[model samples]
Target: MMKVMAFVGSPRKGGNTSKIVNSICTGLKENGHAVEVYYLSELDNVGCKACDSCQANKVEYCAINDKMTTLLPKIADADCIIVGTPVYMLQLSGITKNFLDRLFTFYRRSNHTARYLPGKKYMTVTCNGAPAEAFGNVTEYLNQLFNGSFKMKNVGNIITGNLTNKDDILKQQGVLEQAEELGRKLS
Candidate 1:
């Protein structure tokens, strides 16, 4: 079974984004894959400071000692990663952006290494209050961030749109099913 690190990037705990990620994890677990859901809202995460300490001394890890620092090791060991976020102002949420920023350390140190997180697979889940098509920009942003910046293989992206209320996503049977289906396929 694959070990998947699932990150819920929405600040609203158990919000629409979280539900979508949870659905994916549920399917992964059913398929016998180990899933760890990291809730950013519950952790005290400071945005990346661009200190480059991780590049200078690999042992120091990320310069900031916030919750994300603790996750570095787990992320390094995971076979796959899943990131879910709600689109804010036509972009990824602030927390998600910060998390992505922190990954720059890997980019800095592994600039010449083709195997940097080479075997790992990843997928993105994005939700928006506007039409689903509006999420294309953010979806492409994440895809390029992970696929190009990190050099990780992208499994796929799930975008749920037109969800203004908390329950809007859960009420969308197709999106939830898509999330689960995506997880199953990943497994």
Candidate 2:
């Protein structure tokens, strides 16, 4: 079975972002893929320190001794990564940004290559109160990170707008179905 790592960047439990991620996880599990979900807001993860310790030492993992350090191995071992977040101030949530920053550990200074998790499949789920078209830049940022920097394949993405409440996404049946289909395809 493929290993899938899912990160929920919303602090609210059972929020729209969480529900969407859980739906994706359900699809992955149904397809016989192992899924692990991490709530970023609950984790004590910190941003990249820019210490360059990982690069200098040529280590495969980050040097920071935070919760992300423990998750690094899991990330490396996974076949796919699913990131779900609620838009904040026209960008990703602070915790999600920090989590992405921690991924810098995967970059190697010797050859400017991603040391681990390269070629893995990745998908993003972004929920915003504004129109989806209005936040195309946010999606582009995610694309740059997953496709460009990490050198991962873009499996798919779910960008649902006008979701201000936890249950609002439930009304968007098509989006939910799309998320499940995306997960199944990833597996």
Candidate 3:
């Protein structure tokens, strides 16, 4: 069974994005894969300082000691990484964007032959206040970030539309089901 790390990037706890990710995790767990969910909003994650510390002293280690630093080992070891976020300002939520920025550590590491992570898969879930088509830009950004930057295999993406209210997404049973299926297929 593959170990998966699911990151919920919405700032609202138990919000639409988190609910969908939890469902995905449930499916992965049922399929005998190990899954761990990390809520970015709950973590004290600082944006990447662009310091070359990770590249210099420690080897694959970011110097920042915030909660995000705790994720480096887990992210490196996980076979699959799943990220879910709400669409804000036609892009991923600030929390997710910050988390993505922090991933510069991985990007820098991969630039040299000493890539810490390789052959891993990634999934994305985006919930928007508008229709799914309206948030295609957000999905494309995530796809490019995860695949182009990290070289992770793009497994799939689940987008939920019209999710202004956090609980509004509960009405989209199909989207949640799709997320569950996406998790089941990850490994």
Candidate 4:
């Protein structure tokens, strides 16, 4: 079974991002794949230190000794990754941006190449308060990061909008089902 690491970028534990990620995990679990879920806010990471220690291979992954120290290794070992976030100001949430910034450790600054991230499978989920098509750029940005920059394979993406409430995703049962189905297809 493939190992999948799912990250919820929303601080709200029960928000749309978390719910969709949970649903995807449920499907992955049903398919006998190992799924580990992590909430960004609860991780308490101090964000990236920009020390380039990880780039220098000084400490393995960014010098910060927070939860990311534990998670970066997991990210490297996992076969697939799923990132879910709610759009803020037509961009990724601050916590999500910080988390992505920390991933700079994977890069080789000399040649702008990443060793561990290439060939990894990745999926994205984006929720916005605007219309579904309004924030297409957010998903494209994520794609550019994971697919263009990292050279990871694009497994899928769930870009949706008009979810203003915390539990707004619950009402979109169809989207939740699609998320689960996406998970099942991975395995």
- Per-residue lDDT of model 3, residues 1-187, tens digit only: 9999989998898889999999899889889999899999888786888878876656556888788888887788889998998888878889898888877677655444325455788889998888888888888888877777667788888877888887987898888898788777666
CA-lDDT, candidates in order: 0.83, 0.87, 0.82, 0.89
TM-scores, in order shown? Answer: 0.93, 0.95, 0.92, 0.96
Clashes of each: 0, 0, 0, 0
lDDT of 4 by residue, 1-187 (tens): 9999999999988989999999888988999999999898888877887787877788877678788888888899889999999999879999998889988988788898987889999999999999889988989999999998899999989988889999988889999999999988884
What is candidate 4's TM-score against the reference?
A: 0.96
lDDT of 3: 0.82
lDDT of 4: 0.89
Clashes of 2: 0
| For every candidate, C-alpha RMSD to the true structure in Å | 1.7, 1.4, 1.8, 1.0
Better of 1 and 4 by TM-score: 4
- Stretches off by above 4 angstroms in model 2 are 58-60
Ranking by TM-score: 4, 2, 1, 3
Q: Residue 102 in candidate 2 has what lDDT?
A: 86
Q: Which stretches of candidate 1 lie over 4 Å from their true place?
A: 58-60, 109-115
